[model samples]
Target chain A: MSHPNRLNINVENLAIGYKDRVICQNIDLKLASGELCAIVGVNGVGKSTLVRTLGNLQPKMNGEIQIAGENLGAFNMDQLAKILSVVLTEQPASKNLRVQELIALGRQPYTNWIGTLTQEDKRYIQTNLKAFLLEDLKQRKCHELSDGQLQRVLIARAAAQDTPVVLLDEPTTHLDLYHKVQILKMLQQLAHQSKKTIVFTTHEIDLAIQLCDKILILDGKTNPFGTPSDLIKQKHFEQLFPSDMVQFDSSSGSFKVKK
Target chain B: MGSQRSYSFVFAIIVLALLLAFLLNVSSGSVNIPFTAVLSGMFGGHMEVESWNYILWNYRMPKAFSSILVGGGLSLSGLLMQTLFRNPLAGPFVLGISSGASLGAALLLMGTSMITGFTVMPFLNDVSLVIAASLGSFLVLLVVLLVANRIKDTMALLIIGLMFGSITSAIVSVLAYFTTAENLQRFVFWSFGSVGNLSSRQVALMGAIVGLGVLLSIVSIKRLNAFLLGENYAQSLGISLKRSRLTIIIATGILAGGVTAFAGPIAFVGLAVPHLTRQIFDTMEHRILIPAVFLYGAILMLLCDVIAQLPNSANILPINAITSLVGAPVVIWLLVRKRKMLF
Candidate 1:
C-alpha cells in the first residue's frame, strides 16, 4: 500500500521518562496522515511515556518533536490543541456530565471564552455521534455508561476535536474480546475515512497486528516502526517478552504460553 | 432538557426560599420589628417605631447582609475547592485557611497582652481582629499557592494545606498556653464565629471582597467545567492547568479568607452548601452549580442566622453551631437517600 507524503508527526532523538529518570532514548519515527499506528510493548516499557511525550502532556527530556513541520515546543497549548487530541485512561472527575456535553468539550479550542458550541461545533459533534452510534446515549450521563460505551464516547470526543492527530492510551482496555474488536474496527474506519493520523498504545499485540497499518515495537533493545508485515518479517515481536512463560509465535503472529 | 427544566424549577424555589429567609431574618430579631416596619425600613418608607428603625437599619440589616455575603462567599469557595481537588470532601477550610486566620487573631489577641503588659487594650476592637485574621489567612493562601504551583497532584496539595493548618494550630496552641485568662477568653469568643458582629463598613468590605471572588468564579466557569474531566484531559482541551489552578486558588482565598476574617471562620456552610446544590440541581456543570450554590448558600446562611437568633428571645446562639447542627443532618439525609457516590 502506498502511504501519503503528508506527515502528521515526526520525532527525532526523543527521550521520554518521568522526572529525572529516562525510560526510552534516541527514538525516531515519522507518522503520516491516514495511518493507524499502534505502539505495542510489554507492561512498563514506556509506551505511555512515549505517547504522552508526543502529545506534549509530559515534558520531553531530550530531542525534538514536530507536527506539520512546527516544533512541538513552539506550539502553545491552544495551537497544539488544534493539532492533536488525546484520550486518557483515567476517568473524568465528574461522571455526572451528560454524554453530549462531555463530547462537546472537544470544541474547547474552537469555542468562545464561555465554551458555547457554534453551528460548526454542533456539526462536528453530530457527525461523531452518528459515526460512533452514540445517538441513544447522547442524553445519558457518563457515569451511567459501561466501560466499552464510555471508551467509545471518549474516542468520539477526540474525533469531534477535529485535530489532525489523535492519540489514545489503551483504548481497548477493560473491554471483552467482542467490544475490543468492535472499538478497534471503529478506530480503523475512523483513520481511513477521515484521513487523520491515529496512534494508540495497547497490550493487545495480536489484535493490533490485524487492524493497524503500522506498528511500533519497543522491546528495550530494538525500537522499530513499520507495516505489520515488515515488523513481523524483522522478528520484532519475538524479543518483546521474556521467553520463559510466553513465546512469540512468528508464523501465527501471536504469543503462546509454554506448557 | 429535562434536567434543565428541573434546574430552573429548583432555582426558582431556592430564590423564593432565600427571599423568605431574608425577610424572616430581618424581622424576627430580639427586638421583634414588625414585618411592615421591616419592609418599610428596607424601602426607605416611614417606620412605625423609631427604635425599630435603628434596630432594622443599624443592626439587623448589616447582620442579614453579612449572613448572605458570608454564606455565598464560603459556599462558592467550597465549590471551587471541591472542583479543584476533585474530592467531594474538600471545603474552604480544607486548605487550612480558617486555621491560619485563627492563628493570626490568636496572636493579636493573646500575644499583645504578653508584650504590652496589658490584658485589654481599649483600641483593639473588631477592626484589629479582622485585620489580624485577614493577614493570617492571606499569608497561608500565599504559601498554599506557592506550593500548589510546584505540586501537580491535588491530593498532595491538599495534604500540604493540612500540614500548614496543623503548623499554625501548633503555634496558636503555644500562644494560648501563655495567654492570660481575660485575653484567652476574648480569643475564644472570636473563634466561635459570628455573622452578627460586623459593622456596616465591615459588611461593605466583605461584600466587595466576596463580590470580586464571585466574579472571578464566574469568569472561570468554563475552565472549571473543563476540570470535570480531570487535569490531563483538561490540559489536552487547551486549558492552562497552572493558570486555572492559580485562578481557583486566588478566588478561594478571597472568598474563604474574607469570610473567615469577618465571620470568625463559620463552618459547614462552605463545606455543605455545594453538595446540597448538586443534590438539588442534579447536575455537575459549574455553569449551573455556580449560581445555584450562591443562591442556596445565601438561603441556608440566612436560615441559620434566623435560627441562631432564637426567635423573640434576646439570647442568640453561635452561628457556627447552628450551621453544623442544621447542615450536617441535611447532608446525612441526602447521603442516605441518594445511596450513591456523590463525587
Candidate 2:
C-alpha cells in the first residue's frame, strides 16, 4: 500500500461511439487506487460505451486513456491483461463451466503456456472463492447459479485477476435490492481492501450515491465527475431525468415520483 | 482438484477401450481370419494362412489407422469449432470444408464426362480426386478466413459458411443432373464415405497433417478456454481475436479437409464425439477435453468400421450409414437420460 494514492486511471476529453457516430463526448475522469467509482446516466447516454472504451474493448472516437501512468494504446493485449480486467453484462458463452473453473480463467495471464495452474494461482482462486462467498457453490455449474450468484462469480473473477484496474458494465442489472447492495458493497470492499481501482456502469443511482467514493454522471454534455456530495451540491442528478414525472431531492439523495 | 484427480482414471478407461476397438476392427473382416493369426500377424510373426497375413498388413491395418485419423482429427476440429463459435450445434464441417471437398470431387468425377459426352480422362486416378478435393476445401477456407478478418461477429461468419455450403451444394447438384449414369454412380459412391480406400502413403500424410492440427490446437489451448467466456472477455484475458480465429479456422481446414480428401465425408464422428466426451469428462477445460474427445472419437470410429466390415459376410455396409445408426441413438439416449445436452 505504499502507492495507495497512485493514479490508477486518467481519462481526458474522451469521446466514445461506434464508427460514423458519436454517443458521448468531453468525458473526463481521474481516479486513484483504493477508490470505487460508478458511471450513472439515463438510458441511451452511452454509459456502457464509455466503460468499454476505458477497457479498450471498444474504440474511442477521440481522446486519451492512461492506465497506471501508461498510454492505453501502448500496451499489447497480454500486457493489458496483466494490468486490467473487464466484465461485460452478458453471461459467459458457456454456462456449463463449473463455477470455480469459470473464475479460475482470470489467472490465464500468469499461468503457464498449457494453462496448468501454479501454486500461487491456486491461492488467488481460493481467496476469491471464499471472498465472494462462493465456496459452497464452487462445484456447481454456472447455469445452475442464481443471477446474483453469477454476478458475484463474474466480479470474483475480475478480483481474482489481481489487476490494478477493473471495469464492469452493469454488474447488478437483474438482481433484487438486497443482492444489488450486496454486489456493490462487495465491490467497494474489494477496492478498499485490495487497493485496486474499480469502475462500473450501473442504474441504481441512490445506491451508487451511498456506496461509491466518486460518481460520473454522463449527461451527453459536460459529463461531470466528482464526489457524491459535490455532484449533489452541483445539482447534476436533478438534471438527469425530465422534471415533469420525477424529481431528485437533494437532502434525501433519492428520486421521488409525482402524485 | 477432485475433478483433476479422477481424469487419470477416465483416460485409462478410454485408452483400454480404444485398444479393444482396434483389435475388433482388425480381426472382424469378411476373410474369416482367426484371432490368433490376426494378433501374431500384426506383431510381425508368421501366420498359418499367408493370405490372412497379407490381408492384415496390407488392408485391414491400414483401414484401421485411417479410421483413427479420420475420427480423431474430425472430432478435435469439431470441438474447436464448437468452442470458437460458442455454438453447441457446430461440427467440423460447419465452415463448409466438406461441402467444398464434395464439390471438387463432383467436378472431377462428372465434369470431364459431361463436358464432352465421353470419359476423356482415362488416365485419371485417386491422386486427381485427392488434389481436387484438397484444393476446393482450402479455397473455400481461405475465403472464409478473409471474411472472418473483416467482421467481428462470429454468428455472421457461421452464416456465411452456411451460404458457402448452399452455393457449393447447388453446383454439385447441377453437375449431378447433367452427368452420365456411370459418372453419377461414381460421385454417389464417393458420397457414401469409406475409410478403407487409403494406401500406406496417404495414411502417413493424413497422420502428419492431423498431428500438425493437434499441435496447433494444443498451442491454442489457453485461448480456447478464454473463448468460452466470449470474445470480449477473451481479449480482456489477452487473446487476439483475429489471430486466434484465423488459427482455429486454418487448423480446422487441415483436419476436416485432409480426412475428406482420402476418405469421403465421415459424418457423426466429428459433431457427436465432443458432446459424448463432455458427458463423461464433465468439464469445459480444453486441456482435458481435447485428448479425451480424440480418443473417444477414435474408439467410436473403430467400432463403426468393424460393424461396417460385417464379419464373415461379403456385403460391406457404408460407413456413413453405420456411424449415423450407431452414434445418433447413443447421443439421443444420453440427452434424454440427462434431461439436457451438456454443451
Candidate 3:
C-alpha cells in the first residue's frame, strides 16, 4: 500500500458533464505516484468527459479535484502545467511542423517569453528523443509520420514536459493491435521507471487489464475503480457490455462474443 | 542540418528578389529614371536630371515603401489569422475587417453627399478617407472580439465574421445606389486599391501602426506555436486560451486595419503569401515563417507594383487587379498540385 501523502490525484464526489448537464456523479478516485491507471468504458459512457474534467480542459459541474494536495482550481495555468501534462487525441493544426519542433514545444513552460530553448531544455528534449527512440524521425515533418510513430512522438513530448502526472485521451485510437500494445507497454514502463502517475482513457479493456496498475470502469450505473485483478474478482467486466453482444469469461479474464 | 542550410538558402533568394523588385519599382515608372539616377537619389548624391530626383524621392519612394509595408503587414496578419482559426483558407479579410473599412470609405465618399446635399466636404478628402477606414475597421474588430469571447468554436466565429461582412457590404451597396455618378466613381476608384496615392506623412503613419502590429506578432510567437496543436492541447499545455486569442485578434486588427486604411484593401497578399512561404520554406514554425513571410510579401508586392506601373506608360493598372491576377494563379497551382487540403 502507498502512503496517503504520495497521492498525485484525488477526486471526491465529482460530477462531470457540459453546460448544465451532469453525466456522472458521486465519483471518487485516488491515484498514487508511479501508478499507471486506465479508464475503460463502453462508448458514450463519459470517459472523455471524465478525463477532460481531470485535465481541467472542461469545467467540472460539482467536485473537488486535488493535485498534490492542492485544490485543482486554485492553480493557474502555469502552475498546473508544472505538475500535469496532457496528450490529447486531436490532430495538430499544422502538420508541417517538424518532429523536433513539435517536441521542443513541450519546453514552452520553461522557455523564455520568446520561446528560445536553453541548453538545459535542449538536453531534456534530446534525452526524451533518445528514450522514445525518435532519433531517426527528428527531421521528418509530423505529416510524414505513421500513426504509431506520431503517437510515440506525442508521448515523447509529454515525457519532455517532465510533469509528475500525465493524462492522455485515447492515445492508441487509430493504431494496429501490435502498435496499441507497444504504446501501452511503453507508457507502463514510463510510469514505473519515472515514478510519474500516468492516467489515460482507452477502449482496450483487455490490454488495460494486462498492463495497467489500476483500472477505472464506467458502466452507466456505478463507476468502480480498483486494481485490474480486484475489478475482475468483483465481476466488473461482466457488466461492462450487454450480454447479447459480449460475455466476460472469468477464467481467462477476457471478454468473448455471445454465441 | 540540411533543413538549416535550406532555410538560409531560401532567405538569401527572398532577400535578392526583394532588392531587385525594389529597384525595378523605383526606376521603371512613366518617366523612366535611369538606375544610376535612382541610386544616386536614394543615396543623397546629386542627380543629373532635377526632375528625376524629385520623382524618385517625392513620389516613387513613398509608393514603394507603402507597398512594402502593406505587403508585410497584410501577409503577417493572414498568417496569424490562419493559425488562430486553424483554417488554411482564413485570411485577414475573413474577419470582415477590410469590408468594414470599405463601408466607412463608402459612407464618406457617397453617404455624406446624399445626406447633407453637399457635392463634397473639404474635410472629407484623402486624409479623412484613411481615418474613416481605420475607424470602421476598429469598430468591426471590437465587435468581433466581443463575439470571440462568447464563442469557443473557431468555425462558428468565422461564420459570424462572414455575416458581419455581408451586413456591411449591403449597407455600402445602398449608399452606392443613392450617390451621384461623380461620387460613385470616387468610391469605385478607392475600392480599386492603390499603393501610390498616399503622401510620405500618411505612409509614415501607416508604417508606425503596422510596426506596432508586427511587434505584437513577435511577442505572440510562443502562443502561436502552442496554438498549432489545437486549442484543447494548447490549454492543457497551460496556455490561457482567452488571452492568446485576444492577443492574436488585436495584432491582426492592427496589421490588417492599418494596411487597408492606406492601401485600399489590396487583395491576395494577405490571402496567399503565407501559403507561398510555407511551400517555399517547407516549415510551419512561426519564428521562421513570420520573417520569411514578411520578406516574401514585400518582394511579391514590389513585383506586383512594378508590373502594375506598366513601365514608361502613363496608364497604370489598379493594384487590386494585379495582385489577384498574380495571386490567383499561384493559389490555383497549389490546389491542383496538392489535390488535398494542406491544413
What's each prediction's TM-score?
Answer: 0.92, 0.94, 0.93
What DockQ results for candidate 3?
0.54
Error at B338, model 2, angstroms: 4.4
Candidates by TM-score, descending order: 2, 3, 1
Give the local distance difference test score of model 1: 0.84
For each candidate in turn, the interface RMSD (Å) is 2.7, 2.0, 2.9
True contacts kept of each: 0.53, 0.72, 0.62
Q: Where is the poorest 10-residue window by lDDT in model 2 chain A?
A: A1-10
Error of 3 at A155 (Å): 1.7
Which regions of candidate 2 are displaced past 4 Å?
A: B1-3, B93-96, B108-131, B138-166, B177-185, B334-340
Candidate 3 chain A, poorest ten consecutive residues by summed lDDT: A1-10
lDDT of 2 at A27: 94
DockQ of 1: 0.52
Q: What is the C-alpha lDDT profile of model 1 across B224-267, one tens digit per residue? A: 98898888989998999889988887788778877887888787
Quick one: ranking by DockQ, best first? 2, 3, 1
Best by DockQ: 2
